[model samples]
Target: MNYSIKVTGLKYTMTIISATELQKNRIKKLVDLLKQCENINQQIENLME
Candidate 1:
């Protein structure tokens, strides 16, 4: 099936597709990793100043 999430303060639509338990967990982990990576990148840029 598919899932949709409405983020706060955003008008865009997010779509996610999954078939089983493993798929859902994997997708969640990927999203978490992406957000962490962004934060770390920002920190690195700030430290270079």
Candidate 2:
């Protein structure tokens, strides 16, 4: 099974995917990790600007 999670921010958006059942059960952790990734991406964008 495939699970899609959408995380949206003021200047960025991301889609997280889980391809395994084990990962599906860790959605909350995945979301948190995605949030961290989004923050890092935002910081990179800021540095580039």
Candidate 3:
């Protein structure tokens, strides 16, 4: 299972939220917000084998 991760920083709000369980009727708005994150967002910069 992938854990839900959310990161926020200065000049940015509710960004980089990689979620596992997206509740009903919230996908659109939530996804829009997620896109706000830039390089300051969470998650690995690159994935390797």
Candidate 4:
């Protein structure tokens, strides 16, 4: 999986995040999101073909 974030008007801060950290927080939720994305991708591919 990939992670990215964007924001504006933010003060300097120290932050740390990695895939392992993310999964540890909510692995089930993340897995469900990934599955949903995969299903959508497959549907789009079917339409194109």
Which candidate tops lDDT? 2
Worst 10 residues of 1 by lDDT: 4-13
Tens-place lDDT per residue, model 2, 1-49, is 3334434444333344544666555765766787788778778889999
Clashes found in each candidate (C-alpha, N, C closer than 3 A): 0, 0, 0, 0
Stretches > 4 Å off in candidate 1: 1-14
Over 1-49, each residue of candidate 1 has an lDDT whose tens digit, in order, gives: 3333323323333356535788778876766665666667777879998
Q: What is the lDDT of residue 24 in candidate 3?
A: 25
In order, the Cα lDDT scores of the candidates are: 0.57, 0.60, 0.43, 0.52
Tens digits of lDDT, candidate 3, 1-49: 2223344643323333564455422654554565546333544443321
Descending-TM-score candidate ranking:
1, 2, 4, 3
Q: Kindly indicate the candidate among 3 and 4 with the higher TM-score.
A: 4
Question: How big is the positional error of residue 1 in model 2, measured in Å on the Cα after superposition?
Answer: 19
Q: List the residue pairs that clash in candidate 4.
A: none
The regions of model 3 sitting more than 4 angstroms off are: 1-25, 39-49
| Candidate 4 structure quality by residue, lDDT tens digits, 1-49 | 4333222322223233555755555855655565666667777879999
RMSD of each: 6.0, 6.7, 9.8, 9.2
- What TM-score would you give candidate 2 relative to the actual structure? 0.49
